[model samples]
Target: MRRPLLSEALLDTIRSRAGGYDASNTFPHEDLADLTAAGYLRAFVPVERGGAGLTLREVAREQMRLAAAAPATALAVNMHLVVTGLAAIQADRGETALDFVLDDAARGEVYAFGNSEAGNDLVMFDSRTRAEPQADGSYRYTGTKIFTSLSPVWTRLATFGRDDTDPDAPLLVHAVVARDAEGIEVLDDWDVLGMRATQSCTTVLTGVRAPADRVHRRLPAGPSGDLFMFSLFAAFEILLAAVYTGIGRRAVELGVAASHRRTSMKNGGRTYAQDPDIRWKVAEAAIVQDGVEIQVESLARDVDELVDHGPLWFPKLVGIKVRAVEGARYVVDQALRVSGGASYGSSGELGRLYRDVLAGIFHPSDEESAHATVANAYLGPLER
Candidate 1:
């Protein structure tokens, strides 16, 4: 077998601290620090640039491994990896738009995805923020972004907005801003039911400036078949799915352990592990997790190998995300049923897994969007 990309000891340490961080509702700063020091943050960067240069598929599998140890930590780190992964995709294809991202990653600058909005159904196709263009080719972005993971530690934030000042009305402007730049405020309001350790606080961008060099791409409003867009969607969805799938894997493991440790009084000292119902639940959860694992691995590999799905890629990508997330939910729920009341406690590992899996529902191309994408792919766009 090949050696794991991350050290087992490191993951064990992260797993040990996950509960404490989650209980305190604090960001996994220690995990981030350790990962940064160990260069896991640069896994997607080129080896020539002082990074591991892991392929998208390798990184996705590693994320699944990391998430099994610490869900919130892996989820938070996914934001940084997503940015770097997208840059790596572009660099691999000979694009220069993400050169600055590569340079910054080599210099140990952690990146965060800050493009999500509170009420914007447009997702990445459009933005609610304002990008006021400057004479020097820079832009000042003013808006609010929700779910800014790694909010406390990220050095650079990749953001986007609408440039309505142009007569065209909806230019999708993209830029990367420094976290400490003026007009940037990180609100300490990340109180949530699950994935609490991510500290994905709300960010208020009040005229935050992105200089000309950092401003990467500008496109017309609505989705496009751009390579960069594909990279972003692919990386984001695959890694995000990997995280929840890991949660499901962990839940299944916990359920199995619980079943073995728990004795059934009705069976005269027999373990729950011997109970037919418990066994069935465990098997169901295991099957769901296995299905997601396969989908995540296959899709990630296809992306790395540049398999031409053409117009079908969007539906396929979104389909994996939806399947992985929903499959995880099923696995966790079944695992909880197998483990019984012990998992009901908020501090229990299974309970934490339950809450963490719920967050997968909120990621991009959510149930409605994903279904619409698939429906449109088969039925064609709807008429007004």
Candidate 2:
């Protein structure tokens, strides 16, 4: 957290390049280049591996700070860290490979996702693609993944699929695949209103083979006794909320700067900022943003404290995730209203934030499953 030092200079870089990135609908390659070179992406790897080894709170803070600058790059980097960290843990890839990832992190290598199938919402694990085993322990993977964030730019990817050998296995198989492989096709198909700079596209895999060791198994439950099994979902929710909050904060910051520089049309007010109505709107926006931030941060803080000292409570974490999503929706609505037409324009990061903020309600981590989880915990056994 202290290490990144996200200064005004860093923010200015993001602001300076944001327009160009949004205009091209291209990846925030320049920003990510800075993040990687600065080792921002590797800050969470264990300290034993020479990482900054920040806590969940620290991760959340840095994610928001960077996301405040450019949501697309922040989301891309966050996706990479989540994927690589999951793969790195449990020494899944014979320890040596995971070690290599840590080393790569130390050296500034970033990652991405290649798991969303066309017509398949990433939230459902049952939406598995094909992976057939070969004579070797390895398997040949053939499938097409859509909307893969950071795919074209990142060297590594975490892809989900089903094993042909275990057709009925109640598990989702996640494989760590490289960006460059024979028969792997990257499509230039991502053009959206939000998170446009992520360079998300369709990636087609045609009989690509990777060692079975490269594949990792992700079970339905978190490791037993690990409150984080449920708590991290809360953390993810809070972070998304934080992302929205940061966007709101940036909208205010940009709006304030513009108001001082641009005069109001009504009554020839000295500046848009001086009108009583404009002043009231900005005040209202700040209050709403601050309230949402406090609530989300409190939820995250409570979840962390519970994980460390409170009783093992699953429902609480689920509730936090649900509420965090709610806060995001409210804060984003306020941001758009406060920023006005300027935000909707493609020239600023506010519109990009608008696009990514809506995802808070639908991202696999925050929406539908959470409602069921919380309901099951509080409502008791179901009737047929």
Candidate 3:
């Protein structure tokens, strides 16, 4: 049998720390340190680059396991993985532009996603941030990015902004900026209902410069069929699905255990596990969870194997993400129901899972967007 990416002892340690991190609404600093020491941050970098050299599918599985233990930590680390995974994928296709990302990550640099902007529905295609081209080829970015995960200790931020220097030809300039770069501000505004340990704060860039060497792609704005875009969607959606799937798996496990542990007053003091209604609910949750797990694994494997779904790629990616997140949400809800009032306590694991799972709904390729993508792929663009 293959060695596990995250050993049981390490998982237990991380899991034990999760509640404290959540309760304090603090970043999982210790969890990050442990994962980094284990070389988990470099999972997608090439072996030659001093990394574990794990495949996307392998990393996806590991992420699922990690998320089950400490979801906020996993979700925060997902940003770094997505950046390295994109670089690794590009390198596999003989593109060396993003090799620096892989190199930096392998050398202990933490990368975070800083592309999400308020009111910008055209994610990855356009940006509310302005990227002004400099004479020396570097670009100065100025904008506010919301949900900037790994905000506390990221060394680098993978972000983008629109460069509209020419009125007729606007471009989306993708680049990575050092966290300590001038004019960059991290706001402590990430107190949300769930995923509290992530501390995904707001970032304000006031003419923060991304040096020329770090500027990777400058593509036409408004959704192009670019490989970079495809890589981003693939890495992001698949890994996100993995995290939520792990939550679902944990929910099912908790629900099962809760059923066996809780005794019913009306059923001759028998455990809830012996109740027909509880059994049916658990079975339903498990069934949905099983399907989500299969979908996440299958899609991730296809990405690793370089399966060419072409036009179907976006639809498939979004489909799995939507399914995994929504499925996990349903499973968590069912698990809460199965566990009853005790599970509703703030300190309850089920309650934490319920809150954390809700953050999934806000991730990209949301239900409305996913349905539109699938519809456009199968039915063609609606009369537009």
Q: List model 1 lDDT by residue over 75-178, tens digit each.
A: 99999999999998888778879978988988999898999998999899988899999999999999999999998998999999999976665799999999
How many clashes in candidate 2?
A: 0
Which portions of model 3 miss their true places by more than 4 Å?
Answer: none
- Residue 269 error for model 3, in Å? 1.4
Error of 1 at 106 (Å): 1.4
- Answer with 1 or 2, whichever has the higher lDDT: 1
The lDDT values for all models are: 0.91, 0.62, 0.92
Local lDDT at 300 for model 3: 86
Q: Which stretches of candidate 2 lie over 4 Å from their true place?
A: 1-5, 85-100, 121-124, 164-170, 218-239, 255-280, 295-329, 339-344
Please state the error at residue 43 of candidate 1 in Å. 0.2
How high a TM-score does candidate 3 get?
A: 0.99
Cα miss at 219, model 1 (Å)?
0.6
The order by descending TM-score is: 3, 1, 2
Model 2 residue 218 CA deviation in Å: 5.3
Task: Give the winner by TM-score.
Answer: 3
Compose the digit string of candidate 3's lDDT tens values, residues 1-384.
147768999999999999999999999999998998898998998888899999888998999999999889999999999999988877877789999999999889999999988898877878899999999999999999999999999999999999999969999999999988999999989889999999899999999999999999999988677889888999999999999999999999999999999999999999999999999999999999999988888898888888999899999999999999999999999999999899999987889999999999899988898999999999999894
Ranking by lDDT: 3, 1, 2
